[model samples]
Target: MSFSPDRSQASEAAPVTGSAPGSASGAFAIATQGLSKRFGNRTAVDGLTIGIPAGTIAGFVGPNGAGKTTTIRLLLGLVRPNAGSATILGHPLTASPSYLPRVGALIEAPAFYPSLSGRTNLEVLARLGGYPTSRVSELLEVVELSDRARDRVGTYSLGMKQRLGVAMALLPDPDLLILDEPANGLDPLGIIGIRDLLRRVREQGKTILLSSHLLGELEQVTDWLIMLHQGKALTCGSTRDLLAQRGELVVEAGDAMQLDLVARIVSEADYVVTREDRTLHIACPATFAETLNRQAREAGATNLTIRVKEASLEQLFLALVKGDRS
Candidate 1:
């Protein structure tokens, strides 16, 4: 998948050589420098510098109240910046030309005319917005709403409304799609549907900036991630490089009770136990896995499985924000 960005007089796609990549894709679709926002005495975004690459599924993830919404609002020109500058697709965001048609956004839960049918609403918007009438049906099909195109939006379930909102975003045939918590109202299957649809958009050269709290699910679909903590960028990088928590291997043999004994015996292994039905997982330094394996063997254990399980993005996040020493 690839997204080609318009070339600016001054390049916004250049890498921050002093900083790590916020996304895996080569060129940036959105860039910010020293962007900050303050609401009276409370600072919502503080010196945020983010780079979202073209056509990549970049996860802007953080705990609740970490300024994700505020940052998105600023990028969309809904809120003025208190400092720094931001650009989208090679143009200063504040100086945006008549190029908004090239972008689509679903910020928060999307709104629609409750009394209008889905197709009618899209048709109305299409007519008023100068888009070709032929686009409505195509976008309806894309969002899998063709079958219910005539249903009133007010009668739609939350998941159904979300799909319809995405349909509306697609109606404009945008190059960049920005979604804030797009999966907020979706069911599990609906979430999968949205993820796959976004991937398809990437394949067609469209970039996506996705903000979500569903970390476990997003990790499966996103190529890169940016985590914010207390209104500041904590870490941002490719999924594999940023979240790989490597640790020492703790090998345990025998049934569940022996595993329990191993737990007591190896209490000082410098790792916490991750328990499964019949398995135990622990994180440790690379040096301790071998020693732990040998010690388990000496403790009268015949059955053993010993290997390192790398950390998930959730674990890495906790470690970074809450570890005794990060």
Candidate 2:
């Protein structure tokens, strides 16, 4: 269950110093500064800077073409950055060899021999990676695939395959796990399984960088969040901190005039308001819900319904991206 490697085996390239400004090198499992990558005239990642604390599930999210994959490639040393620097597991990007062994990644769909049993596929990977064969069995148990270990991978469901992929990543007993869309194409139950598995992985003291588009699912599991847009980090912080920044009061009245009155009241109070048919969406704190309800009643609105809604990951993503574009 231990992922700690011998400190003596660490890179001699000297640990990166203050790469994330105001934070010590040991503060982050992954840190990047001014990291940029380009493809001819198109920039994939632009001066990207982010810090993912150790031993936490950090959600890596963005719209398509946001440079998420490119950043992952850069981190894995699959591609060279056109500019900036990065550090993984205390080793600079220039010394990826020293740290990559401790990092496990499953980017995109995992490829496996359809005809091979799930156990055999893992055994093959373990042998090729020089990992202990015993880890294969242990991982099968961890991914809850032991019952189906002898089953052909072709017979496995997409969820099972994803779990197997995770098992392969865990085979290295990595200290850091980076998964790109592990829940993609999964049903609700499969997604829940992945979430639970991630929690189990984190309990083993592993830091996880989960890149996924399922914001609702991410909101449930991620302790930290890094929102990417146009190859740059638009916002990165603890999930609680990010979501706490915005909330809304949804009000619906029996008549259009009542709705308009409620909207005017919210707007006059300096809160942003948007009208959609009979509903009034007021951007404000949840704490104001009581006051809003009282105000509507005092405004002579006989039939009114009000609800306070917390900001969801989807809402935060849209708000951040919209603000960034503006």
**Alpha-carbon local distance difference test for all models:** 0.73, 0.83
User: Can you give the lDDT of residue 100 in candidate 2?
Assistant: 95
- Candidate 2 residues 198-273, lDDT tens each? 9999999999999987789889999888888888787877776566445677787788988887887888788889
Pairs of colliding residues, candidate 2? none
Question: What are the per-model C-alpha RMSD values against the true structure?
Answer: 9.2, 10.2
- Per-residue lDDT tens digits of candidate 1, residues 1-326? 11111111111122232133445323778777778899998888988877777778888888888888998888888888899887787668787654466888888899889999999988888887788879898888878889988999899888778888887777778888888998996889989988987888889888888888888877878877787777777766566445433333445566876677667655775567767777676664434455565676677664676655445777777776773332
* lDDT over C-alpha atoms for residue 235 of model 2: 80
Question: What TM-score does structure 2 among the candidates reach?
Answer: 0.79
- Which segments of model 1 are wrong by more than 4 Å? 1-26, 245-306, 323-326
The local lDDT score (0 to 100) that residue 288 gets in candidate 1 is: 48
Candidate 2: list runs displaced more than 4 Å. Answer: 1-21, 249-308, 324-326
Model 1, residue 107: distance off in Å is: 0.7
